[model samples]
Target: MFDRLRLMSDYEAPTPVWAPASVGAFVLSPTHLDHLGLDETLRTRLLRWQQYFDDHHPADLCGWDSPGSSQRYASEGEQLREELERALPGLRVELDLWPVPADD
Candidate 1:
């Protein structure tokens, strides 16, 4: 996704993860990506995942934190995460509340 950007081996992608949605999880990476190219690169990856998530799942499946929402395609989400891990190892799926970019 970020093929144009100058990627680095040390660059850690900011994965979105759930955290009760009330207290919230550290959706974005805590580490500062000082490199402009790297930040954009990470965002590109995130946005791609966001699009995939939106397209595959229903809008109301906010997270496990939602009321009576635990059973809404629960395994599907996990499958997505697993697929992501297998596809992009080392970068755990942490994306939860991070908003995906609009198709511009």
Candidate 2:
């Protein structure tokens, strides 16, 4: 089982994992939102973020072009981190800094 969960934005599929084959680490992207034991409110927020990303940055690497949208996404990511920690105390939650330029 994974001991840590990372939250980050991505292109079609966000790879939240920090390192390849890293011990006790895994990504908790929106794709797995349905299978996880997330509260309704938290789940809804995640779903919204996913939809927002899909709509705004469908073909882009990141949603940095729109400052407002990216900021909102980052804010929501922070909230998700907190909610995930509360819901799954067993796992360590990490939220990646958002608005990271595609070039970076």
Candidate 3:
């Protein structure tokens, strides 16, 4: 089993990306779901989370402009973290919040 799994949203895109806690450079997107060592049930959950994130957040940076955007993002991240923990007990799950946008 992987030591750690991190869930994060990047500026390049709002989609959630999962990576090892020790390594941020190597990430697994939702599409790369082939022999990932994760069982089909977990893989399906991860993909569902990705799709949910993509659907709720804007694909570009403009998403930050909307009111309560930060809170919304954090809420989703928290939910994902909870899901990860429930699905993989004892696994370290980190939710890396993106930089907060400046108030206009």
Best by TM-score: 2
- For 6-99, candidate 2 gives per-residue lDDT tens digits of 6665555543323213753444554565556676787777666666766666565444557676666766777777887788778787777554
User: What lDDT tens digits, residue by residue, belong to model 1 across residues 1-104?
Assistant: 11111111111234333222344332334242233223455445544444444444335654233323333323334555555455444444432322222221
Expressed as tens digits, the lDDT of each residue in 1-104 for candidate 3 is 36677777553342355667466545665554353445676666556555544555556644555556566666756876786677666778887765444452
Best lDDT among the predictions, by candidate number: 2
On the 0 to 100 scale, the lDDT of residue 45 in model 1 is 53
Q: Among all windows of ten consecutive residues in candidate 3, which has the lowest summed lDDT? A: 9-18
TM, every model: 0.27, 0.66, 0.60
Global Cα lDDT for candidate 1 = 0.36
Candidate 1: list runs displaced more than 4 Å. 1-26, 29-37, 60-104
lDDT head-to-head 1 vs 3, winner: 3
Q: After superposition, how far is residue 74 of candidate 1 from its true place, in Å?
A: 14
Superposed model 2: Cα runs more than 4 Å off: 14-35, 60-65, 101-104
lDDT of each: 0.36, 0.61, 0.60
What is the number of backbone collisions in each predicted candidate, taken in the order shown?
Answer: 5, 0, 0
Q: Better model by lDDT, 2 or 3?
A: 2
Clashing pairs in 2: none
TM-score of 1: 0.27
